[model samples]
Target: MPTLASTNAVEIDGLGKRFGATVALENVSLAIPPGELFGFIGPDGAGKTTLFRILVTLILPDQGRATVLGRDVTTDVWDLRRRVGYMPGRFSLYPDLSVEENLRFFASVFGASVEEHYDLIAPIYEQLAPFKDRPAGALSGGMKQKLALCCALVHRPEILFLDEPTTGVDAVSRREFWELLDRLKASGLTIVVSTPYMDEANRCGRVALIQRGRILAIDTPTRIAESFGRPLFAVRAGKRYPLLLAVREYANAGTVFPFGDALHYTDRRDGLMPDAIASGLRDYLRGRGFADVEVKLTAPTIEDSFMARMGEPERAA
Candidate 1:
């Protein structure tokens, strides 16, 4: 086992990777502090998983360097593996094994016993106790996730990496899972969670928005939202499809994206007041055969920030 040498849990510099002709990651760099809840926010195929795989030492980077717990991910892989916990995007527990069996298996891999590390995972394991005897395959999606989390923490690692932990779980389960992570962070555990859901970004202490193998921005969710430097509005009308097209075609449109039940829009005329923008949007939509159209000033969200950032061209390679 390697001794901790610094407060930074993970560090990466100019990291890049590729699979044949397909680029997976490019010029990526980031540093996660010990005990911080850091989030990698991006949509599917955004290279979030590729980054986690490299950081956890499961794969090699084509360029640059990465360190976890002060140990190089490539050169010090053996020692690094012992100090971090990883729950991949998919549920990877042995299907034939009972929940208890899976937990025991992971613990044994680290030369530890479940009973010895039970306290470390108790908060999450307690909810799974009743299903201890059930085969992992028989459990619900949420239960399977919990079992994976317990298995990941059985050895009490210094840093944890969860790749889209709440992807397929229900809304309630997602909420509960984040609550569990919050508890873990409160106990001084460093966590790096990647999620395609923008809403989850707000739950993280800091977030990095990634797209097409590049990092768009890295900052707190609040700061990311605040960085949207323009007034925004939620616009809706009778038909969303036509409304979306009309909004995009408007001469003064800055950015128009579909945002669940409404279109999130901003005006190119940043100097205009919110009320003026709203009034202008209504007139534009109504002129384009939209009826009962409504446009109201709205606050920016992490999703808004992501859309705005992604609209820009990819940085020079």
Candidate 2:
């Protein structure tokens, strides 16, 4: 049984939800401490959106229970809605409305004015102020996101839930968005964000990796990468395709997947030293007619850990 703690900003126990034949979430449970910039990391269709909807009081769970800010999400939904801010995965603000209109409208919905909580959204709102007259639909992807975030913050809710907030945005915009999140976290706002990008996981204080409606792992980015617990190597060759196929055919290969420009390889046999493994892999690749093969022991990243966990057998629900 999972228990909720008063100290926790958000808590869930044995939470499960299904959509007809599709299982959206299954026995998910976790506790997020207050003021923490927590993230739910996973690829598309990994139950991230469903979980966020439940936390933000937009949907009811089929089983189990969840509490946000010590209030039951299922029973205290109306109260929770008033205290929490949610920015859905899609752009939900009115497209025909000007930026300022959208902000004022959302503020009024919460029975508050933009002036009352100006300080809460100043950092982000300042950027949008210049384009206040512009229709939200006419703004760039990044600007639209900023506008949505400002609206979400206008009421100064205790916690903010952002679902894939950076998806479809430019690379530079993604970086800028995370910086805004850092500043928000510094202001002692508890933020719960979900993203499909593995690199974004590093920005979170802690992250939960979800796949196929199940929680695979949860920990700091560094700790999760450390948990890979295997001798890994980055193998690169002039001929990428051939090298990948060759490495996959190796007898000791546990996992081989293309990672950026190199193929990250892990061995099935344990107890072999890193140096010995690297040398063996290099020799094997060289024997396969790849004279330009470069094999080196490499530190595992959060993506590596995610891939490893994803390859494991699914846990029984």
Candidate 3:
């Protein structure tokens, strides 16, 4: 595939787009290498969908340009469509059509046959075959997601764009879906997926945390977590809520945010000490009828790094 600089599968530089008065995407630039599993993670209204649309040629940018597989998105949309696969967040498969029918329809639309691409979608289609005769709308959330993915893969696209592929899926289904993605990545398919779940950040090779149409940070999940520049401690009292309030208001509070069952606290950047506050809060919480109370330093999570980076600029520390 030809890239703008000859080293990327898709390239976007100084890209800008808008929807009436609202800015959909602003100066967004990213390069995805060939056969890479890139992720574009963010919350609702984060311009993820907008950027995907622009890259896939569903919409054009007002400023800057984007090229996919070496073809300009604006001028070579027809060829780009043949080279890329997209699975929108919504289920766009034909509701009235059967599972096999939906798959065949999309395959024929691209002038390809399911038999020709069975190897490309075998991992996913195997699970979908049991319900091949069922109406598209009758499949469970997990089944529907798989069917959608199979439809997207039937064309053997060089670059796959999945927008929140696991949203609204059951826990088991979500895990299974990711497992399928891992196998697909192993097959040398370049993937770019977006999701709002912070825990899923680790699954991606690298992620771009976005909010309010701006990026907070872009780095490997481990690197992002390690970028936390403070000594973090997890504190839990028998009474958790009050304990959280107390720790958050403490004079030493640098960043106080809730973890799973415990609260994570860090000393202020200025002068507050973590050990002193931990010792003090340990006693303060126990005095309030807390049992088996625990306080100790802990590792930062993806959500922690996202919140911290969101509070700062796009540049990493």
Give the local distance difference test score of model 1: 0.92
Tens-place lDDT per residue, model 2, 1-317, is: 33344789998999999999999999999999999999999999999999999998888999998999988888788888999999999999999999999999999999999999999899998988889999999999999999999989999999999999999999999999999999999999999999999999999999999998999999999999999999889999887898899999998899999999999999999999988998898899888889877889899999999988987754432
Best by lDDT: 2
Model 2 misplaced regions, further than 4 Å: 1-5, 314-317
Give each model's clash number: 0, 0, 2
- The candidate that wins on TM-score is 2
TM-score of 1: 0.94
CA lDDT scores, all candidates in order:
0.92, 0.93, 0.84
Rate residue 14 of model 2 by lDDT. 98
**Which regions of candidate 3 fall more than 4 Å away from where they truly are?**
1-5, 269-274, 284-291, 313-317
Of the two candidates 1 and 3, the one with more favorable TM-score, higher being better, is: 1
Ranking by TM-score: 2, 1, 3
Q: List the residue pairs that clash in candidate 1.
A: none
* lDDT comparing candidate 3 with the true structure: 0.84
**Which residue ranges in model 1 land beyond 4 Å of their true spot?**
1-4, 288-291, 314-317
Per-residue lDDT over 1-317 for candidate 3, one digit per residue giving the tens place of the 0 to 100 score = 44354578888888888889998888877777887777787888989898888888999999988888878999888988999999999999999999999999999999999999899898889888888999999999999999999999998898899989988887899889888888899998888899988888888888887776666677888988888877788887766777777777665567778789888877765455767767876776666666777889889988888788677754443
